[model samples]
Target: MKRQHVIGMFDSGVGGLTVMKEILEQIPELRIIYLGDTARVPYGNRSKEELIDFGEEIITFLISQGAEAVVVACNTSSANALPDLKKSFDIPLIGTIEPGARLAVSKTSGGKIGLIATEATVRSKAYSSAISRVLSKGVLPEDQGLRESWQQGEQSIALVKSQACPLFVPLVEAGLSKTPEARGIARTYLSGFDTAGVDALILGCTHYPFLAPVIRDILGEQTALIDPAQAMVDELKSVLDKLDEVQEMKAKSTVKETWKLRFYVSGDPELFQSVGNTLLPGLIQEVRQVIWGD
Candidate 1:
């Protein structure tokens, strides 16, 4: 008679669906509750205070609806509000930046990485800070001496160059991911990475993955694209392993086969469902709309 373990996730719009897709692929046994704050879509230009307020409301709502742990799937919110939100919440709160940074550092061959995200995220410099923290951990005493031998502009560890692509979210939401207009914008936003010579590019925003084709054509096939969703899911798996409820649920064979998913949006549910199905293809069903302050 134990309850199902529910993990809640939220993003500004349909972007977090990418992370949910990864979670479903890796750990399909856990029930999931996803919220898309489409009424406040494109949080890229919002202030940190506003982001924090939005996150508080969303997480509180999710927790009230049986979420045990929550994932901040929007890069802007993760960059600006994650620390504060984590402190405020009692349950485990995960963000995409640290996991993405760790994975990007491991994938880079030349210790050079690129990041493309929303304006608020790039402005916060969270990815840059996270990358430095990840790289610093692996640096040895001997590496300090080798730093002097590095080229005029390169570092001995990882170098992260981040750009904010504000239009990407709208493009993906509008289902224009593969259009010529999308390619044009991708080239405009990603032109610097071509000259920066980044061997690995972290798709810093969850929505950016939908435009991966446009990005690859602009950056060329040699550059490795890092999707943080995979790393985030890996982290979620480890977190779930430690939870008593998850452990208890896993002990029952019937529970393992009875996982469920629910979708809630603060804006037009029909539009959210349409775009979600496009990104995930028939995976989304019965999206419910919830108004704020309801």
Candidate 2:
């Protein structure tokens, strides 16, 4: 008599609300549980070890609350901790990198994509590897044995340029997404993509979506700005669809249930709730605090 799986998602702070917003809109019937490690709001500069430890603590808490599937909405966690979490947990899980990569690869005609993320995500080269995997497909069979050449690093396929916009998370957290400072930072970081002829730019960090207006203004209408949150949710919908088809007998979250979006933060619940209300009105009227090492 186990109920349907509740989706669990986490990030360093309120930035993950972008992903949560999409899930709420797309699958309002399903139950969602969100955790934001706001006490450590910026995971972009954290070491891989720290990211793994934080990720484990957050995921464990979510699982304890009856989460059946997990979403690492934070790019840093997806980059450093996803593989480890997958091994440790038996439930179905998803991450931000692959879905974003797939979207950029599909939308970019010139195959020139740019990525803006935290220092850690850029340093890890997660987007580069993910995009390369997507680009490996559809290689012309006559072009010097396409698959072989591409695999051996001979083809000049998709080029993904990355820059770590380290200050972005703090700006977003402070509610400065619309400020002149945000625009200046974006202009400085994004000017290169114009000359590089980037057809699409992936906002690799969960926080970057809040600065989309500033980013789009700099990149112009021609350059498609990619929001990984949207891409992640789109893919999650596909995943849930397949699961529902396969597990028709299992009781699932439905419109009839009294399920509501639950929010938790390791930092100030008041601040997180304040920001979340702006992003998804009425859905985040209250938030709970998560203390560590209890």
User: Which number leads on TM-score?
Assistant: 1
lDDT of 2: 0.81
lDDT of 1 by residue, 1-294 (tens): 233468999999999999998988878677999999999998999999999999999999999988889989998999999999988988999899999988887667666788899999989989888887875676221233334443344455455578989889999998889899999989888888878878889998999999988888888778989999988988887678667565666675433545399999999999998989988899788889888884
- What would the per-residue lDDT of candidate 2 be over residues 1-294, giving only the tens digit for each residue? 223447899999988888888887777767889999999879999999899889889888999997878899999889888888888888778899988887776666555778889999999998888887766654222234544555577655465578889999998888888899999988998878888878788889988988988888888899888887777887777777766766676554454457577889999999888877765567686789989985
Top-lDDT structure, candidate number: 1
Could you give me the TM-score of model 2 versus the true structure?
0.88
In terms of lDDT, the poorest run of 10 residues in model 2 is 138-147
Model 2, runs deviating above 4 Å: 1-4, 137-155, 245-257
Of candidate 1, the 10-residue stretch with the lowest lDDT total is 139-148
* Number of backbone clashes in candidate 1: 0
